[model samples]
Target chain A: MAAATESFTDQAIEVAGLKVRVMQGGRGSPVVVLHHSTGGPGWIPLFERLSAQHTVVAPDMPGYGQSERPEWAREPRDLAILMNAAIDRLGLTGVTLVGLGFGGFVAAEMATMNPSRLKALVLVGAPGLQPEEGEIADQMMVDYEDYVKAGFRDEAAYTAVFGETAAQDIKTLWDFSREMTARLTWKPYMFNRRLAPLLKEVRTPTLIVWGEKDAVVPPACGRQYKRALPNARLEVVAGAGHLVELEEADRVAKLIAAHAAQA
Target chain B: MFIGYFTERPYQDPSSGYFGATGRDLTDLGMSNASYDPRLGAELYNRYLDEKVYAEEMGFDGLMLNEHHSTPFCMGGVMNVEAAILARITKKAKIVLLGNVLPIWDDPLWLAEELAEIDMISRGRLVTGWVRGTGRESVAHNAQPPFNWERFQEAHDFVVAAWTRPGPFRWEGEHYNYRYVNPWSRPYQQPHPPIWIPGVMSRNTVAWAAKHRYPYVMLATELEPTRQSYQYYDDQAKENGYESGTQNRGYLFKVHVDETEELAEAAARKYIQGPSNPFLEGNQGNVRPFIQNLPGLTSRTNLLPTVQSFALAASRGRLKEHEAATGKKAEAATASADKQDAADFLGTFTDQINKMSIITGTPKTVIPKVRHVLEYLRPGSIFFWDGDGAMTHEDSMRSLRLMGEEVIPAVREMGKSLDLSSPFEVDPRTNQPVA
Candidate 1:
């Protein structure tokens, strides 16, 4: 894998009258990244690696990160609509949509709504489908630090990404992001009951990825996503947790690159 | 002065293993009703109702009731039901609901109708109040936390409109919408019953209450901070073009009176013995920070002084320390010490008394403490929080008798000297000295 040395620039774009903070870089095909419930993790190693081959455009979902909050938006589907409008404003075509965790739910909704606009759909440790055996871990049950740590497989992995303790500003951002998540996804938790049926309608090529030890959303959710989408494949990354993209950025980026190339 | 009586109406089942040395130290949100006995619930509810009746006989001007959900700390989850009962059961004492959790109600029109009926049944003796409920209420009722304040404001408006306006009015709101808001029952009180607001923190609530000229009741907050909170209310009232007075302020605190100081102290110590509630100081169990301070429930930037104090105490691990101490005390008392001593270790009783958080003594000592509170805060209305935690029927009766016989008369004289007049006496609307 090439070194993740690609630099990205932050841009504020207006979508549906809401200011969306978008981080874009690199060249060639467009890969729009949707962030987790705790908002965007900035231009991380995964985005950098992806940007090396493709134009990686990561926008903080409305009400997350630097994006303007829409008080009227009350569900993942609402965010998905806003994101689709954002994609249209960015003038992107044949896009590879990559969603992480809560972002995955939004991505799936967007795909179900407009499958023809995307060349590929990638869901990483997402939680839009109700697991048949286990349940999605409730983020509101613990403190912000504990919830973030739960995303990683170990303390080392957590420290590597978020440091020993997050700064006060970062903690504040996490809290703000969680409030948005609570506003959008408090009921039925992170999953939409109608999503499973809607997923069966989407004909877009999809790649469902899960960590082997993903504790936040069960690995079985990956299999469910695979079964729901007609043209989808599942990949499990070993020794990773919910945040498989961050923990194994090189490997996941390689898989995405390979998948996007085929699409 | 409007003297009222209040209690958490705790579900004190000693067999539930939630009370005592050998019990599971359960937190407020963590408590499950799996061990709840309907038989005990029935008895406790009736007993509490009986006590309220006795309170009316004991000459309390009003009976204050509050609502909390999914917890044993307060059995009045649907406190309106108690208010409705009190309206019919008691003749003179105002049925004060302070208050219904506004944001939790999906339909405020229904709440309006309920209150209207209560007012009519009580011959217009109703003091309706509203609250922006805690995270527990939001979680229990599945109400959106981010829209709590909005929903509360909207709900209050809707209920008031429903009560005062003509029938068949179309209502469309951000949080609620109704095609027809006409209820057959209107409030017996002209222009509707007086609205009051009770709060511990949340500066926004205090300011809002002041703007509306509703009596802002400080619920057992520290004396100094309570004074400061009242000052904030006064400042807000001045900004809104009114000079606020004692009629616009109220205070509720734990005050237990008995024949002797020792007996009063023993019964008062039961305040921290039973199931833990985050609102109650010196609780045995720890509140989950995430659950207690749910995102968007209350803005962090808009907090009162006591919230910072609570945060500081939480950061210092005071709750954990209290739990550990209580656990050890329970273990040590297993062989010899009585049940009272075992539970007495739950909190520093002396500290609470010294801090004036909990006042306990015979009428003479307790009356002086009450006078001190009146002099310090000068609230027009006062509610003595009694018969809570694990205090028995006899213990509650003794306190009520002592309060009626001695403490209340002394407090009334003190109220006169302090120039305190309740909202009922002085119209909150016109800021008149007397209505």
Candidate 2:
């Protein structure tokens, strides 16, 4: 079956000098869901859950989803600034930042770039911090379905893309992911050696999550992340895959809540 | 867990992450000092053991290990031997040898003996995997490369022969020779630890697995292609050619979980897309030997163009020889082919290299996605690939612990009629099965 992911509501907002589309939901302490290349509109369920208590805002990065691609922010750090501006434009003061995939890179930047601005940071299935050699070898691919099929704990991500579903979510995820290729493919994924050291500068209390069976970024790489962030915590979702938070929503929510409460 | 999942080429220096020193590739030949000194390899193996032990201590049900050579990605170039050392490491967790490259390794028999020894050592916690390997890998060591699929079939038999035989064994074969082919330390598990073979172009492998009722692990080359392999196995079983349910088929791929899609995308950017390796796209030519395996295999396929380019990376002094040997007719034919096959899908051999699965998100969002795969790939067990660069140690732990505590439970609750009894049937662990 053709695997698919459901998308989320799309809203565009101009932040700083650039205009970006955001798929936002919920209301309360703001928690931003930064999507990877698969792009959002494929709103994750966790946001829905968090929306009950916290304002869960997911923005399709500049190149993906509802967000307009900005010419200025080419690197992740640049993307982080754009994210901060989006937060500011929405009038979000102290926000809990959570990023997945490439979004995690943004979260990492957010945490250290301006520690005071972000209340807490959560990096889910993030890559590129500790250059752990020869473990994680999941090849990033061409289409959205490949994202899930390549090895998501939620096989539905892949099947949903092909099967009959809420066209809205699938379309959003598809469109956003397609838009992201402009930047993600601007430079192929996974090989930049410069950013690893920058991660050390990130001082925000962070939580990194990974799929134990994550083929894309091996768990070992996740473990290396533990060493990079001084006030960071790591969790390997067992059985659940690359999308640990999606696979194990309750636990992820609990961790998010716990970390947020404590941090 | 089948065996080991290696990065393309890893850094073996002590400074590198993933606890290095053992990662050096001895066979690489290109390095001023290639091949981790077997003793140093042993030391790094100790680190591996330490890591394996930690895997068990981390509430994991199994310890994962594998082999690789000439590259730092995976050290167990020879998994059989690695298994022997692992046998003494831990008793609580299952031992998985994601695989041994049977086609390249000269002796699958010795591999079997080592497998038994390790199985006995683990007191039955052993799982074996076989693979034809990516095309580039086969050409590195084995005499027959690209078209060696036929030879792999033969080598597979000898290995299995050594494993299944009840007593002393003697075999005469085109590739291997052995007189005393018996396990002194028979495996603790009945019928030897489970066997798992995951890869592309393994129709014959699947048929063999079915005949023996062994579970097969399938991380299909691609999502769509996976269906074809699934059908092949199903048809084989329908014909009563192989075991059906009990003969587990564990599928694998990438997964990213997060509370929201946006969060996932963010993580994907850093962990997956942020670093963006510039080397993977286009004619990255990672495989030349595999192409050289068959002068003909190189011709018609889109991969040959890149193969023509990558053969040099081997660093073997003779690549120039191959380049020199390119006759005028071949060049002329290639030039003529370029014109004729203008629209042809070549040049960018690594196109399939990027943008595959990259699951990033929260468990709730990820569970259903996993269930979807269970129904599709139908793997008895599962494996995950972590992005290198180590997102952050603390963050990673939090994520992993959450994965174990949260994700597994949710997925199990979704229970589709899957057979957990099959050898390949097990829960996902850290690149290893949690038994």
Q: Which prediction has the highest TM-score against the true structure? A: 1
TM-score of each: 0.93, 0.45
Candidate 1 per-residue lDDT, tens place, B132-235, comes to: 98788998998878889999999998998998888889998888999987899999987999999999778899999999999999988878778989999999
For model 1, the stretches where C-alpha displacement exceeds 4 angstroms are: A1-6, B307-309, B312-347, B433-435
In terms of docking quality, model 2 is incorrect
Whole-model lDDT per candidate: 0.86, 0.54
Runs in model 2 deviating more than 4 A are A1-263, B1-64, B81-86, B135-137, B240-243, B256-356, B387-396, B416-435
Where is model 2 chain A poorest over a 10-residue stretch in terms of lDDT?
A135-144
Q: Across all candidates, what is each one's fraction of true contacts kept?
A: 0.88, 0.00
lDDT for each residue of candidate 2 in B1-435, tens digit (9 for 90 to 100)? 221222211233443222222343322223333424566555655555554455455445544454545444455566666566667766666666666767677767666767777777767878777766543354346333323454566777876666667768788776577777775666676645666666544346666655555556654234444555556666776676433552355555555444566755554443322112212222211222323232112212122122222232121222333333321112233334323122122323223323244455677766766666666655545654433222333334444555566765555554334533334444221123345
Please state the Cα-based DockQ of model 2 relative to the true two-chain complex. 0.01
Model 1 pairs whose backbones collide: none
